[model samples]
Structures are given as structure tokens and as C-alpha cells.
Target: MPPVKKIVMWLVVIFLLYAIFTSPDSAADIFGSAWDVVANGVRNIGRFFDSLISRS
Candidate 1:
């Protein structure tokens, strides 16, 4: 990838590590929220496809 993209990725990694180390509870909450978001996204996609299949 490009240099800028690499730098941004490293920064994100460092920030996540700092967050986890500094506050475990806050980090757990953040990860839980992220999981919920991903689960909702997958559920929505499945519903969309199910609707299309039922209509046809």
C-alpha cells in the first residue's frame, strides 16, 4: 500500500493499544459496540436478500 495508508494504519494500531492498556473497561465497551454494529449489518443484509427471494 501507499506510505500514507501505512502511517494511518500504524497510528490506529497504536491508539487502540493505548486505549486498551489505559482503560480495559472502556476498551471492552468499544469492542462490544463494534461487534453490535457488525452483527446488525449482517442481519440487515440477510433480510434484504430474504425479501428479494420471497418476492420472486
Candidate 2:
């Protein structure tokens, strides 16, 4: 792995640890919000595909 990638990964790990130790509730909220955004995008894509299939 590249040095930059290692450094970035380490930084992310440290930040996560800090967040978890300091405010676990907020950390959980953050993950939940991110998941919702991903799920919404996936649903939108599925709707688009369904519309295309209906048209054909």
C-alpha cells in the first residue's frame, strides 16, 4: 500500500475512535443518516429502471 493511503487510513481510524469515545450517540446518528442517503439513492435507481421497463 502507498504511504498516503496508510496515513489517510490511520487518520480515519483515529477520528472514528475519538468520535466513538466522545459521543457514541452522534456517531450512530451519522451512520444512520449515511445509510438513509444510500438507500434513497438505490430506491431512486430502482424506480428509474422500473419506469424504463414499463415503457418497453
- Candidate No. with top TM-score: 2
Q: What are the runs in model 2 whose C-alpha is more than 4 Å off?
A: none
- List TM-scores for all candidates, in order: 0.88, 0.89
After superposition, the stretches of candidate 1 with alpha carbons farther than 4 Å from their true spots are none
Tell me the lDDT of candidate 2: 0.98
lDDT of 2 at 44: 100
Task: Output the lDDT of residue 49, model 1.
Answer: 98
Candidate 2 differs from the real structure by a C-alpha RMSD in angstroms, to one decimal, of 1.3
Whole-model lDDT, candidate 1?
0.98
Q: In model 2, what lDDT does residue 1 have?
A: 67
lDDT for 21 (candidate 2) = 92
Error of 2 at 26 (Å): 0.6
**Model 1 Cα lDDT, one tens digit per residue, 1-56:** 69999999999999999999999999999999999999999999999999999998
